[model samples]
Target chain A: MKRNVRSSLGLVVVGFALLTSGMAQAAETYKMDTEGSHAFIQFKIQHLGFSWLLGRFNTFDGEFVLDQKNIENSKVKVTIDVASVDSNHGERDKHLRGKDFFEVEKYPEATFVSTRVEKTGEKTAKITGDFTLKGVTKPVTLDAEYIGGGKDPWGGYRQGFEATTQLKLKDFGIDYNLGPASEVVDIYISVEGIRQ
Target chain B: MFINTETQYGVVSIVLHWLSFLLVAALFGVGLYMVDLTYYDPLYHELPQWHKLFGVVLAVLSLARILWRILSRSPTILAAAGWQVAAARSVHWALYLLLLLLPLTGYLISTAEGSDLSAFGWTLLPGLFELSPALADWAGSLHLWTAWGLIGLATVHALAAFKHHFVDRDSTLIRMVYIKGQ
Candidate 1:
C-alpha cells in the first residue's frame, strides 16, 4: 500500500511540474483588432407614461490575451470611458456625466476584469468577472463564444470571440431612475483579436 | 414675506416652462429605457431615431427657453423661507443645465462616435462630425453619468413639488401648475 501511495504521489508531483514548465515556456501574446471589435452597453427605462425605453453605450475599448494552444490561458480586459455614455442624444449624454449620476469627474472610467473562465466547448466559454462603473462593482458573467480562429496568410494567429453580458446601471452607482429606467442594462461585445 | 408670485407667468413662460418640463422628463425616460430594449428586440432598431428626434426637439425647446429667460423678465417669487427658496433655485438651475447638457452630449456622442449622423431619417441637422472610438467612448460615458445626474435633479424637483402641494400646503405648486386656481 505504501509503495502504491508513493508512486501516485510521485506521478502527481511530476504532472504538476510538467504543467508549470509548459505554462512558463509557452506564453503567446494576442493583439486586439479594435477596428474589428464591437463594444456596446445597453440600458432601459420606463417610457413617459408607458413602457420601458431602451438604448446602448456607443463606444468602448476591448483588450484580450490568448494562447491558441492553451485556450484556458486567456484573459479579457475591457475599459469603457464613462464619459462616452451615449443613447443617440446629446443632452442626455451630458447629464449622464454630471454629478447626480455617473459623476464622471470623480469616476472617469468603468472597467471589467475577468475572474474565472469555464470552457463550454471548443469555441465557447463562460467568463465570470467583476464590472465596476461609477464606483460600484458587481459580479458579471459573460457568455463568450469563439466565432472562428485561424492563421492569416501572413502567418499571424487570429482569433475571434463574441461575448454578451447584462447588468443594472444602478449596480454601478448610477441609480438614476429608481423605477423609471429599468434597473437592468444589458451589454454585448464581439471581438476579433490577432496574436502579435 | 414668504409669499408666492402675485400673478401668473406670461404665455411664453408658461409654454417654455411646461414644454421644457415635459421634454426633459421625456428625455430622461426615453434615454434610460432605450438601454435594454435593443438587446432583446430586433424591431427596436427605430428607437435610436426616435431618441434623436425627441432629443433635437428638447434641445431646441431648451435653447428657446434659455433665450426667453435671458431676454424677458420672469416673475420673481416673493421672499420665501430661506431653505425653500434655496432649494427651489438649486433644483431649477440643475434642471436647466441637465436639459441643455443631456441632449447636446447625446448628439455629439452619437455623431462623433460614428458616421450615423442622421439621427433618424431626418436630415435637418448636420451630420458633419466623424466619430472617434476613444472620443465616442468618453462621450458615451459622460452622457450616461449626466443622465443619472438629471435623474437625481428630477427626483429632488418632484419631491419638492410634492412637499409644496401636500406637506407644506404652499403656493409653489400652484404657481407651477396650470390649473384654474389653487
Candidate 2:
C-alpha cells in the first residue's frame, strides 16, 4: 500500500511540474480593448469600370493569442457586426444590408478565426483563416504586419497589427450585379489588442 | 462647307447638332427608365452608373456646342414675322439652357448622394459634396422638372419644324436638314 501511495505521489508531482512548465510556454492572451484601441476595417470595390468605392465597418470585436517565442502558434479571431457597414451614404448603406448584399438582418455577424500562421519576415506573417460571412464560410489568407507592442500609460500591454486581404463578394454570397464592378474587393484591417 | 452659311448649316454645325440631339434624346429615355427602378431591381446598381456616365458625356458635348455657337456664325433665321422670330429664338435658347441645367442638376444630385461621375471605365469626377439626403432629393426634383421642360420644348420644336416643312411650305426646316453645297 505504501509503494502504491509513493508511486501515485510521484506521478502527481510530475504532472504538476509539467502543467506549470506548459503554462509558462503557452501563448499570452490579449483581450481587445474596444474603447481604448481602434479597429479600422475598410473595404474597396470597383465602381463600374471607373473608380474604387471605399467603405468601412464601424463596429467589431476581436482577441488574439501571441506566442512570441513560437510565433507560428499565435491565433487570432475577429467578430464584425455586419450591420455597421457605412459608405458615407445612408441609402447605399441600407441597400447594402438588404437581401441583395449583406442581408444583415439574416446574417448579422461575420467572423474570422485563424487556422494557421506562417511567419514570412521579422514583423510580417501570413495568417490563414476560415471567414464566415453571410452564412457562408471560406478560407482566406491575410498578410499581417506586427506594428509593435509596449506598455500603455494605463499600465497595460498592447500590441498593434495591420492586415490586408482581397476577397470576392461573390464568394460571400453577395453576388449583386455591379457589371464591371463585380470583381474582387480589397479588405484592410488595422487592430490593436490589449494583454488580458 | 465647314462653317455655317446664311443659306444652310455647314458640316461642323450639322454634325454637332445631330449628335447632340440624338444623345440628348437617348439620355432622356435612359433617365426616365432609371428613376423608376426599385431597390430590388437587378439593374438598380448598374443603371444609375450608366445614366451618370451618359449625363456627363452630354454635359461635355453641350458645353462644346455652346462654345462653337459662340465662336462661329450661325445661319440667319428664315424670313418670318417679328413675333414668330421671337418665339423661335426663345425656344432655341431655352433648349440650350435646359441642356446645361439638366446635367448640372444631375451632377449635383449624384455627387450629393456620394457617387462620382464615371465615363465607361474612367472616373472624370469624384464625389466632392458633403452627403445630404435633403440636398439630393431637391436636386433630383429639379432634374426631373428640367427634364420635363426639355421634353415639352423639344416636342414643340419638332412640331414647329414639321409645320414649317409641310404646312408653311418654307425652307426653314431645309436649312438645318440639307448641308450647304450638297
Candidate 3:
C-alpha cells in the first residue's frame, strides 16, 4: 500500500510539470486577415503654411504576435503599398507616385519591423522598430495601444491595435520642396489581426 | 488735386486708377502663363507663390479703391448722348464688380484647397476650411472665367476712352490722365 501511494504521487508531479510548460510555450501567432481586417494608414502634412493636407494609403498588410504572459516578446511586422496613396486628387496622386516623391515603380513597398516592445501601461506599449521607406531604413518608435483580444463569433481568436508616429519626409529621401510647407508628416495606423 | 470735382478727378483717383490698371494687366498675363505649367516644371511651385502674392495685393488695393470711390466725389460723365453716358456708366460698374470678384474667387479657391495666401514671405490669410475638391474646382473655374470677362471689359473701356478723346474731342481721357485744366 505504501509503495503504490508513492508511485502515484510521482506521476502526478510529472503531469503537473508538463501542463505548466505547455501553457508557458503557448504564444499565440496572429495572421493578418487582409480581407476581413481593417488596416488604415493615414498621414497629414502642412500645405503652403496654411493648413494640413490629409491623405491616406488605401492598401496595406500587416501581422503581429501576442505573448500575453511574456509581453516583451511580442512582435509586429507591416508592409504598406506605397502606390496606393490618395490625396483626393488624381493629378496630385500621380505626381506623388512620380520621381519627385515616392518613385513607386522602382521602390514599390514600405515596411516596418519591430525590434523591441516596452509596456508602458496595462494596455499601452512603446514599440521601437526599423521603418523602411524609399529604400532607406530608419529607427522609429510607435506609441501603441492593445485594444483587446478575444474569441470572435466565428470561432476565431482576434486582436486589435492602434498606433501613431511621426517622421520627416526628408529623412526618407522625399525632398520635394514647397517652401514653408511642413516636412514633418504625422502617421496613424490601426490594425486588426486574426489568430492563425 | 487730392479730391474729385464736377469737372475733373483728383490726383488720388488718377493714381489709384492707373495703378490698378497696371496690376490687373500684369495679373492676367501671369494667370494665363501659370496654368499651363506642369508638375515637373521648375516654376511649378514658384509661380503659384507669385500668383498668390500678387493676387492678395490686388485684392487689398481693389477693396481700398472701392472704399475710396464711396468716400470721394466723382467727375461728371463727359458731355455725350444719353445712351453713350449710360453705356459708359454700365461698363465702369462692371469693371468695379470684376475687380472685386476676381480676387474674391481666387481667395476662395486657394483657401478651399487648404493653401494659405502670402505676399513676399508674409502670410496674409491662413487656410481655415476643410479641403473640398468639388468646391475648389468650381471656384477655380469661376476665377478663370471672371478674369477673362475682366480682360474683355477692360479692352472695351480703353477703346471707349480713346473714342472720347480723339473722336468726341472731349476731356474724358485727359481728365483721368492730367490734373484739372492741364
Candidate 4:
C-alpha cells in the first residue's frame, strides 16, 4: 500500500511539472515573413493651391511576440525602410528621399517597438509603442485586431494580425511640400507571423 | 548660331513640357484630396493608378520626345543673358532626363515587386523583364529622389520664369506661353 502511494505521489509531481511547462510555453515568439507581409502608409497635403496631394510608403516588415497567459505582456517590433516609399512618380520619389523630406541617407530605417499591449476585448487590443522615423521617435498607439491564427500547409505554426495607426508627418520630422500646417499622415500595418 | 535645344529637344521637349505640367497638376490635386479617403476607398486606390497611368504616358512621351529631339532641328538661342541662357538649357535637359528615368525606374520597380502596373482602368503597363526585389527597392528609392529633383527643378524653372517676366521684363516666360499673338 505504501509503495502504491509513493508511486502515485511521483505521478502527481510529474503532472504538476508538465502543466507548469505548458503554461510557461504559452509565451510564443513569432517571426515575420517579409515576403508574405504587406504594409502601406498614406499621406495627404495641399497641392499648389489646387487640391490635396496623396502619397504612400510602400515597404515595411513586422513581428509579434504573443503571450496567451498574459496578453498585456505581448510585444511587437516593426521596421520600415523609408527609401521604398512610392507614390507612382519617379521625380517625386527621389525628392522624398532627399534632405527636404525623409532624408533617408541620415536615417534609413523607421522602427516601431511596442511598450504595452492593452487587451480591449477578445481579438481586439490597443498597442501603445514608440515609433521612430527619420531619426525622430515618439510614442504612438496602434489598434490591433486579431485576424485569427491557423496552421499552415508547411506544418509551421502561424498567426495573422492586422494593426493600424495614424500620425502626423511632422512627428517623424518629415516636413516638406506641406503648406502652412503639416498634413496628417495615416500609416497601415498588416503582419503575418510564424513561430521562430 | 548657338543652338539651345538640339534635334533631341524639339517635339519631345514640347510634349514632355506640356504633359509634365498637366500630370503634375493632376497629381498635386489628387495627392491633396486623398488625405480624407481610406486605402480601400475607390478614390484613394484609383489616384495611384491614375498617377501610374500618367507616369507611363509621360514615360512614352518622354522617350518619343528624346528621339525627336535627337533627330530633329532645334531652335537657336538668338538673344538672352548668358547665365539665363545656360540655366534654361541645363534645366530643360535635366527635366527631360529626370522625366524619362523616373517613370522607367518606377515601372521596373513595380514590375519587380509583381505589382500590376495597370494604367487607369484600361491599359496595362507591360512588364518588360523578370521581377527583382533588390532592384525594385533601389528603383523605389530612385523614384522618390527623382521626384524631389523634379520638384526642385520645377521650382527653379518657375522662379526663373517669374524673374524673366516680372523682374527682368524679358521674353523667357513668354517663349513657352501659348499666346495667339504677341
Compose the digit string of candidate 2's lDDT tens values, residues A164-190.
999988898887777755468999999
The lDDT of model 2 is: 0.82
What class would a CAPRI assessor give candidate 4's docking?
Answer: incorrect
Error of 2 at B50 (Å): 17
**What is the TM-score of chain A, computed separately for every candidate?**
0.72, 0.86, 0.85, 0.79
Best by DockQ: 1
Error of 1 at A40 (Å): 5.6
What's candidate 4's i-RMS value?
8.5
In terms of TM-score, which candidate is stronger, 1 or 2? 2
Which sequence of candidate numbers ranks them by DockQ, best first? 1, 4, 2, 3
Query: Model 1's lDDT to the true fold?
Result: 0.69
DockQ of each model against the real complex?
0.07, 0.05, 0.03, 0.05
Candidate 2's residue-wise lDDT over B1-182, tens digit each?
A: 78887777777877878888888888888878966676458886687777777788788888888888888887777646788878888998899999999998887765665667664577878877654444554576799899999989999998898888898898778777766455
Q: Report the TM-score of the second chain of model 2 against its true counterpart.
A: 0.90
Better model by TM-score: candidate 3 vs candidate 4:
3
- lDDT by residue for model 4 over B1-182, one digit each (tens)? 22224212233355556776887667545644743454236575666677777777777777877776666665554336697678788987898888877887778765663445675556567656644334555776677688778878988988877886888785556555542231
Candidate 3 interface RMSD after superposing interface residues: 7.6
Please state the error at residue A191 of candidate 3 in Å. Answer: 8.6
For model 4, the DockQ equals: 0.05
lDDT digits (tens) for residues A1-196 of candidate 4: 9999999999999879868776445677887777764334555555544676667666777777888778998999988888777665544565567676788878888998999999999899999999898888899999988886778888888877777777888777765545554456555566778877
